[model samples]
Target chain A: MVEAFAVASGKGGTGKTTSTLALGMALAEEYDVTVVDADTGMANLLFHAGLADVETTLHDVLVEGGAPVEAATYERFGMRVVPCGTSLAAFEAAEPERLRAVVADLAADADVLLLDSPATLGSKSAILPIVLADRVVIVLQATIPAVSDGLKVQEYALSYGTDVAGTIFNRVRGDVESAAEKADRYFEGPLLATVPESEAAQQARAAGRPLLAHAPDSEAATAYRAAAARLDPRDGDSGDVADRFRSAVVPDPP
Target chain B: MIPEGELLRSRVVTDLATALEDVLDRHLDGYAVLAPRETLLGAADGRGVLTFEDGVPACAYHVETDRGGPAALGDVGAGPYRFELYALEAAALEIAHDADELRVPPGMPAERLAGDPALATRTRRRAGVDADRPDDGGALEAFLEDEATVERIRESARREARRRAEEWGLGDALADRPDG
Candidate 1:
């Protein structure tokens, strides 16, 4: 039973790409995971995957419709990354519905797919994954504006009918939980999980490596791993939070 | 009581905006911190937006290297800022990887939420299409609706926050606190 999760942000820089690879990696540990760079406008998940020879890409499926999902897939780091080829123009020009059809074909190749998207639903075609994704995981910042944008995106997705699995509080620090809470309240689902703010992610993005792989033991890395646990297909306790915190996340899967 | 993790994170963002505001006050009349509709429009407004998902605070330089040529999103300035904000997209990856403990505050009012049953049904239908033949057009229409809603709600949120602060004293004591 494969599941498709669309990783879209109301804005960029919400740790969408990094989370995609990390989650895919974590899931790959148990399930066959595939990460697709839906950011055809700026397809860079390959950079996050730390793979340079992304000779084959998502464009083949969208434009040429040449390869089946497996052909467009790149198995790396023990996972498959369906890179958004280097052609932004092609992706932008491709029809939104056609792209969705292509991705659907592509999703068939993997048990779990992470569709990485760009910020803003600017291009109607660009957002195919948001509403179509089996689980829409909205990424949020801890700021009033960031939270607001996230809430709006989630609300909109829900309104238009997207299964907003939950909110991902990224780049959070000492006080973001409240901001995230406000967002969770208005959003149609739970604020499910959060990622502690860390410099490690910046370092990883620059170095082109997953934080877990590069700084495996860093607090940020551990936090990333914990976040992955919450997204797991399995339902149970991760035992990483305060007892009260544990109960807060487990019972509510919005 | 501050929920330092959440409050501090929000404070830092406000702090960043204030810092930007100072720059704007001293340099420009009104500068917008262009971000996706998903970005907190509560900050200064800007038509040109950048991805700021990281929670750590750092000043990025607007390094204009090329026009219609290759340009990299560059950070040119460095300062002793208090905190940082992670790019939300990247955070999603970390969460998926089970890297960090993406904890929602124990204080979030989850009980107050109202799930949009439509979302689940739509997702189910898409899931069916996803498994076989996903209608890309349908997805696109849906995505547009979501995106449009994101921008609209962001606007509503900005107004709401302002209302709360002005009428409800949300930022009453914090006004005296060293926000930036």
Candidate 2:
């Protein structure tokens, strides 16, 4: 079965896109992965993935009635990508509701699909990726505001009947144990991985490459691999955490 | 909401095509009517022949009746329709028409046009158009079609884009900043 994970965050600057790309690269080691830039309004994943100049994008599929397969341009590094256009015209013209169909079409070919969603939870377009996904993996920093915002995203995903796969604590710094304990307590699901702040991640972003490709030996890349391992839907352990959390919160009396 | 450039382009193209059709209806005997495919949504069918110019749907035509002509001519279905082609912008406008409602006038500002309660509710019910305030024509078209309107729309789109970009931290990501 194809498993689609929408990488989302309540607020911006949470390394959501980076985590999506990094985890995608790691998952590609064993599965056919496709990372989609579902953030139609402010698309930057193409640039991050060094595919900024691609002519065909998700905009064409959603707006111009083009085939979804035509939008998959970058097919290398054991993965593919459906990039979104940066122009305001493309964003305005796109039919956000069509994403459900697009996702369905893509599921035929990909084993793992990672959608990098927009930061905002307000826009109908922003919620589309999560609504269509089988699971949602939130990326967030370890802080009160970030945790609260991540919880909002979690609740939003749950409202749509999508499973919260887990949360990845990105850019962990200073104290690892304390951050992990705090995140475990606040977050509803499992803490997938704690990626430490590293210069290699920044360098990979600058080089427009995934950390797995740019710095394979880096700590950030290792954390991403660990996270991807946990996210593997084929693994029997990778069940819906939201269901478990729900049962725990309101357990049925025996 | 429709982009100003796209709204303007669609209006110009549809107006020119509609004017041509009106003239053809008045004069020519059994002549084919050519129009922008998008504007002629109510009329276009499987039999209509769509032609592309510069990678855009320039015009679409359907023969009223097939008058036996030269074999080569029949292949292209070209006839004495006196076709007048006008090149406008490439973008196509999505015009929503409910058989029960009055057709939105071409070139009418989107905000003013959507202000009609019936049309507003109808457009909102449609999937692709804006749900709250469907601006099919555009918001800034009330001003003179000069640099002011252009600048205003440009500024508005820029601000909107910037706000979205900031919300996603796209600027910092594009600049390769660690702060993102």
Candidate 3:
């Protein structure tokens, strides 16, 4: 019984990987967490987790005679990181349903799964994987267009009858008070968190280290933690949230 | 919601294969096509996978065959099945995360029915479509977006199929997905 959250931002550079890895570490205290490389397009979650040399990865699992799922699965801050790994192109050639099937298998093993989706819907070539998640968290920066894009996704989510957890303003700069207030008012759900822009963050990703691991005390880290704290596994209540997905209906299902 | 990694399962893999096979049969019919035993739709390295075609081809081909008979309309049975199959591949496109409209172009049948439940009212109006209003009730353009409106979608598809059947001289009653 897996409770999954899809971290989506239609626009790039929204700190989706940072949030995913940070939440992966933060959520580890309660249950078995796994980060799914749902970002099949340009997967970079592994690099953020600092496990570049991973051996038996998902790419291998897709092909014949590859390592086992246990072998491909690795530990990251008490949580497991299912490396989508290299050889991604070959897997994609297999197509969407196959990709969704593979992603479903990985999500089944974890108590909670965090999917780092690509920013562009077009980049979301692996469509089934996104729809498979129990929840979708839209991460956005402090910009009108970004929030608007996130809202559209939120509207699409309404058909499922589940409200999007809310938007997280990543890399916020200056005292944009009005912008923040307006953005909050515009959203249908909570505006979960606001992460400040940090030079340390730019440095950490550049140095290939997670901010929570590299600079735990950073302001951005604190914001991430606060946002992370809001996500209560208890609220999900014994896998009923994701398990009872049938209660949610398709949006505009023609 | 399906979890991220859950798709990697062998059992799920078989289920997906079956779904895709059904899609192939629904659209391609008698055409020789291969559904890759396994397809991967993941993304990594800053780019989504390609080769995994998510959009309907912009091209459409109308092949007239002597053996298909004058009344046969479009023959997806033999050569040039790509266009016809693509036209009937709305379900396949949905699996690919593509919201392509089979009734739109290239693959769209000349005639369409308003049998879709979502558009039951519109479906009835489009029953005997006239060409002056191309976007009229019976045209493919009149179909709604949500496929979950099972009756509307099927009725819409039926109308389009029927229209095309008439234009091409093919008879009525093309096998459409039942409302079950």
Candidate 4:
């Protein structure tokens, strides 16, 4: 079965898109992965993936009655991407609920699908991705507000019957051990991985490439690989922390 | 029928209608009577039928001069002799294609707009409107008169309504409603 993971955040500028790109590239190392830009309003994933000027986008598929498969831009870091348009008119015209069919069609071809969601809570644009995905991975900084927002998103996802896969603590500055423990306690889900603040991330962004493809040996890239390993469904020990936390905290779904 | 130039000139009449609405709402206790000069003139010409767009008085109108003169009303003679009021009606239209082009962020390449299918469609539609517009100072009239432009606006409104209904989980109920 294909595992669809939605990378979302409570607030903007939390490195959510960056984490999605890195994790997608790392996961593509061993599996067929497709990263979808589900942020219909302020889409930037295409720019980061060097497909900014792609002819077709998710807007065309969702709003303009174009085929979903036609929107996919292949061969970007050995992964497929359905980038969203950055036009306000397109944003106004799109039907967010139509993403269900798009994601379902994409999931059939790929082993893993990562949805890069917008950072808005309760809005149609943000909720559609979470509702359509099998699980959600929240990307957040190691701060009170960020962690609080991530928990709210986790709660929102659970309300819709989707599972909270875990949280990725990105751009961890100074110490890792304390940040990991704090993140684990606050997130209520597994602390999947904590990526360090590195110049390599900036360099990779500047070069319009994924961290793994730009600097394979970089610290940030290595952390993403570890995160991807835990995300792989083939591994039996992948979701131990998440399973334990879910059982302890979340009641059995009706 | 109003001349094309007169219809185009009605664009400025929006301000007069707004002013009349504001003044009447503040002072008048009940309904106010205002008639377009064309309607009065048509009545004098023995034409019984007077037509206006959507019940809005078209063209200019002044205060009734036969009502015991201006000084008979309090402070009427101290002000201007002629008062013009034009009833306003809302008209929906598509945004000009160049609107998105103008909003493109500084330092960003213009090619990105061309690559986006929806933006391209909007730009193309606006371009079509611009190309079809008459150069003889009746652009607004031509735009409103164009069947394609009016249909595009209607289609956009329908799509917007359907999209909203779907988002709120009311699509089934909306579909069950009687067709317009």
For candidate 4, the docking band is: incorrect
lDDT of each: 0.48, 0.54, 0.48, 0.53
- CA lDDT, candidate 1, residue A252: 9
Q: Which stretches of candidate 1 lie over 4 Å from their true place?
A: A65-68, A89-96, A234-254, B1-180
Query: Candidate 4, which segments miss by more than 4 Å at Cα?
Result: A234-254, B1-180
Docking quality of model 3: it rates as: incorrect
Worst ten in a row by lDDT for model 3 chain B: B43-52
Q: Whose TM-score is higher: candidate 1's or candidate 3's?
A: 1
> lDDT by residue for model 2 over B81-108, one digit each (tens)?
2233333233422321121122222211
Task: Output the worst ten-in-a-row residue range by lDDT, candidate 4 chain B.
Answer: B106-115
Model 2 lDDT tens row, A1-254: 46778999977777887899898989888888888888878887887787777788787787655655555557856788888878888777776656655665665567788899999776656765765577899997644335545766765565455688888978654343443554465445688998976788878888887778899999888998999898867422223322222222111111
- At residue A196, what lDDT does model 4 achieve? 76
Model 1 CA lDDT for position A223: 61
DockQ of each: 0.04, 0.01, 0.01, 0.01
TM-score of 3: 0.53
lDDT of 3 by residue, A1-254 (tens): 56778788866777888888877777777778888776655768778877777766666665555556677678766778876665646555423333444555665566777888777643224222344455678887544335434654554333333346667877764354444555565556577788886887877777667788888899988888888778764334434544433322221110
What DockQ does candidate 1 have relative to the true complex? 0.04
Per-residue lDDT, model 2, residue B163, is 51
